[model samples]
Target: MEVTPRLTWNEEKSLQKLLGNVSLRLLYKSSVHGNSFGTMLNKCSCQGSTILMVYLPNNVFGIFVLESYPEMSEHLKKPTTSFLLSFQKNKIMEMTAAFFNSTVDLIDNKLRFNFSQVQYVLLRSNTQNIFIPRLLGEKLGLTYDFKSQYTEYEVFRVEGMKDEPGYINRIAGATPHRDSLLAELRAYRPYADLVSEIRILLLGPVGSGKSSFFNSVKSIFRGHLTRQAIVGSDISTITEKYRIYSIKDEKDGKSLPFMLCDSMGLNEKDGVGLCVDDIPHILKGCMPDRYQFNQKPITPKHPTFITSPSLNHRIHCVAYVFDINSIDNLSFQMLAKVKQVQKEVLKCGVSQVALLTKVNNCNGVLQDNFLQMSESMIYKSQVRDVNMMLGIPKSNILVVENYASEREMDPLQDILILSALKQMTRAADDFLEDLPLETDAIAGMFQLCMRCQLPGSRHLAQTGIADSLFETLLPFMFCLLSLRASN
Candidate 1:
């Protein structure tokens, strides 16, 4: 006997939104085939692109697989482009091949899932929801163990609309390319001898994924999904303190040769978000990590300010994060604030790039394959708008999707993120290469002092020499330092 799909109209609509206008065809139902792992596998085998839904007392959850299930397997199969979905929470978490290989198993006439190294059986109970241990429940975002009987479980084969356009072919050997890109980034070194690590600052409006970008970059190296930074959606900025984040190699635990500095998001309203006046201090590297942002910007009088920041402390590059969905409709005040911040950045001679984030939210086609972002008309127009608005070259603008609700690492996502990071490092190198040498800076300082006609400047001008270069350099250096510090 065949049973109807249990998904409601709203649930089906939400799935289409994520998977891009796909229809679901029921393949198996627990009540019809019996609550046995073998029977369920037999019915679902060879059904490509399936959605497996499990019903609890008050919620529904499932996994969306992009490949067909084999008839039998002692080991788990790789399922790239797959994700876990919770209908009640309206959340979707991307699943990785490595996670799939280690956590799922079919044995003893039951489907088993491993969480925190503990195995729990599923699809074995006909009268009730499968008992989920506390740890497993927590992983599923459930506050308590679910004890209610399972209403039913169903497997559906996802079919795309005939009129829907096909995805751009996956880049050849994209997985291997991801590995190579990771290797390249891991071996990166700063271009300047005086600077051991380049610092890239993230600046953007509130809820633009500024903090989330740092978390995503860190997660790529960590080899798992991590939420070291607090992230949420709100009218106000979620990040209140300036944070300097460093990524560590997963194997040797050595810190990478770059830092990502996060600041409060820019708000259009006065006395909100990141203060525009703080930009100069941040670019010059005077602001300390974990310094709280206030209604007013930091000044030289701030106790936490660094008086003599070194070359390594200064920002090597600035990444302005913008939501792709909202880039077209940016408020006038917000654009003005961004331009004002850019001016401060320009004064310090720092390099800048624009990072367009939340690409998936803007275009449904990108949810399955972010690599196709370049082919998306919507994506291209948004990038163009960002380029025009920021005055950054089109090549310097990068698109990326941050890990928001994933428990595992996806190779495709890694490729996009690492590529963006690679561009940022290259930009930092350019900035370092362009820096004036110490002797040149000193010479320029002397010329400016002579032209200003300070005390003893007339004698120095007449003699074309100074009694002591060191003595003359001292006062000028002090003034320069003071000027730098004040900014």
Candidate 2:
């Protein structure tokens, strides 16, 4: 049997394309036989895994050996095999020299390749040892050394392996948390690669401008106003459920294949909306009742909503639309609903972005006339009540006016939607990348991080002191709604 000699590192420099991936480098490091090869295996990330070492003359070459056998233990232990297949010093020297030129130190204890860095190195092993030059010689009708130790070597080698998924993570932003929603929210780029679809919910009460705004969003994609109303009447009874809309076209004009769930409008008779109530239908991976804990049902009459903790891991973000036309001052009920939204988000690990709609209709979303009302809502309903009740951040609240004739709702929609989506995508990507693989305490730490950094929390910071105080105070008004529900 003839064994091919290893090529000198410089001899095959032209074959640089062969060592294109990080995995191959690792494989060469693990499977080669030699003391020098054994030393190189220490640089790999596959700690505690048995490694294969090959002996070449100049330096050690080895890759993590994945296969194992009790009978081959002694052979596996020794770098050099003394049998007929023993490596020639010259062949080994050439292989080791190539590796030294290709490998470099990456953070402490980690060795990276000049080409690509791989998480796991896989080696290609074959019993047939063939030399590139001799193979070329045979094709050219040139007689070459068939068995000479100096001239013949088997196996052309290269390092670095390409991991497509790993490449995706590198391009996407890296975050520290484990929850997929948070990860999507945090990543810099849209997760069109990892997740095939995104679920969204458009929420607000009757006359809150939810429909008009929904129509506006649809208009952006179709290049015309919504021809027909998307809202539908309930067949079951007088009670009107909120309508659901799938935001098929992203703000960038990319179309989604399907419409998202839009809730029916809240009946005008009830004088309250079920924005929180419909949350269960908009999200995924949560039991109707619980994520981890039994979720409290949100009655239309009550302004508080609770969800199982696990809901946080599933749903990505919620767009809370409020009417700019209604009550210049924040109403206790409105504050209550906001609090309920905040609480549900926190409980289920969802990110919230607030939208104050209908600015144009009221002479301005914020008219001089509603200043007092806005202040009252800020002080009486929102600040000390709602936010105080649930400890939601004021930054999450956004004030928008869809009715502004001077500035159409399109800009507002673009800003709000883009901001929210950007935040969500960035958050989710970050969480996924740095997320520890360990499922124990590490997962808990990830969950905690998601709560504080979500878009809702970030927005709360932007609401300013007056609005913050208003949100804090509004929860008390819920007492009436809660009491009314019980009655």
Candidate 3:
């Protein structure tokens, strides 16, 4: 069998550089009710290199093949693979969003990882030159040719495309009820026993004391401090890498299982970091190739990239940390960044909350002035006339005074923890609601594709576009109804 071109050492290193430290672990579940696609790939064997397969049958299928150049494998540590096919602009956007949302889910669930994990991906298609590469290349302006002159092509099918076993699908293949889930999530009680995770992104410029605030929170958990601690410092020591904290609730002031993620403080150069600037690239690094696609867009057919099942749909809420006493008066600018993050969070149905750090030492006059500025911001940033944006109530923006005084810290800690838990509880409901909706969305999309009628629509129809559409979709719809009733 002929294989696709693999990236040279420099090329693979460049792609890996974009991924940062994140890695993924690929797990192929047993075949579900059917193995139509699984069977086909199983039979095809690569002549020179092992092809990494990311398959979510009835949902999406992606292929990752090693390039022909073995010279590239002699990188510093271990060599990496490059994606074979490219995607279009729109498809790239869709898949990139999927990767971000899904990675959050996986990380929240605490999955395993390896250094030589599946990095690059390919979307398997019947034809060599599909729409995947063209769309992706156009979006990033990368040079790509699906029919790469350096690589040879071969057709291989699994022995029994229909008889494959041991492929189990996720969640019984049902559509989730988004609107209903949203409504139910709104009613989530803060004290309800929820066994879910919360993703707290602390974003701010350097010198905002983001690290101090996080350490203060840790101190509270460690019992070294009884009050809600807020650290006021001039600079931060955090350089790179994400710091994770596990928080829990206990009767003796020991609630374990709390996770705090201290991301690298944002600066000018970080604006374009692959993780921050190219959201898709970071997510793709976290995702397995099995969930990717190789098909590119062509005449008469709309090419949309798909992704694998995500860990969760919604982020509980975002906490924006701002220095309240900055001599430069950075509140307004901080508000703008918060708004930007709020918009991104809304995409996955999450809410945003503003955190005012270093409030204890602020003079009375500055306090009043800061409050007024914040209120004005709330007015401008407010999503709707009724109250909040994306179904979040306006009362959710939390302003706590983080001071070093033990006397002042007790109440602040209580209030902050309560607010954080409340926000997280609501987010969990939103996350659950989000998953089913995503599945239903894919089903709905495929249904639209099935109804599409162009000159050669019949030929496209034979690609299992319709049957695969229904198999995954109908179940999703049924599950949504069942969930609604239960709610």
Best-fitting candidate, measured by lDDT? 1
For model 2, the superposed segments whose C-alpha errors exceed 4 Å read: 1-194, 227-244, 247-254, 257-261, 265-282, 285-314, 327-334, 361-395, 403-487
lDDT of 3 by residue, 64-88 (tens): 3232212212311223232322222
Ranking by TM-score: 1, 3, 2
Quote the lDDT for 234 in model 3.
Answer: 46
TM-score of each: 0.61, 0.34, 0.35
Please write out the lDDT profile of model 1 over residues 1-487, one tens digit for every residue.
4467788766777566556568888888877777776777777877777888888766777766666666666354443334444656433332212223224567575565543356443555544456666544555566686555678888889887333334312322334567678899999987734356899999998999988998999988877678898884748788999999988989689999999999999989988889888898888888999999998989889998876564656899999999888998899999999999999999999999999888763333233344444454458888888888888997789888898875445556677788889999999988888887763354355456555545554443333222367654664765566668879
Worst 10 residues of 2 by lDDT: 92-101
- Estimate the Cα RMSD of every predicted model relative to the unseen true structure: 12.3, 24.0, 27.0
Superposition TM-score, candidate 3 onto the true structure: 0.35
Candidate 1 lDDT for residue 322: 92
Residue-by-residue lDDT tens digits, candidate 2, 203-258 = 55555555555565455445334523333222212114333344444435554422
lDDT of each: 0.72, 0.35, 0.34
Stretches off by above 4 angstroms in model 1 are 1-172, 361-373, 439-487
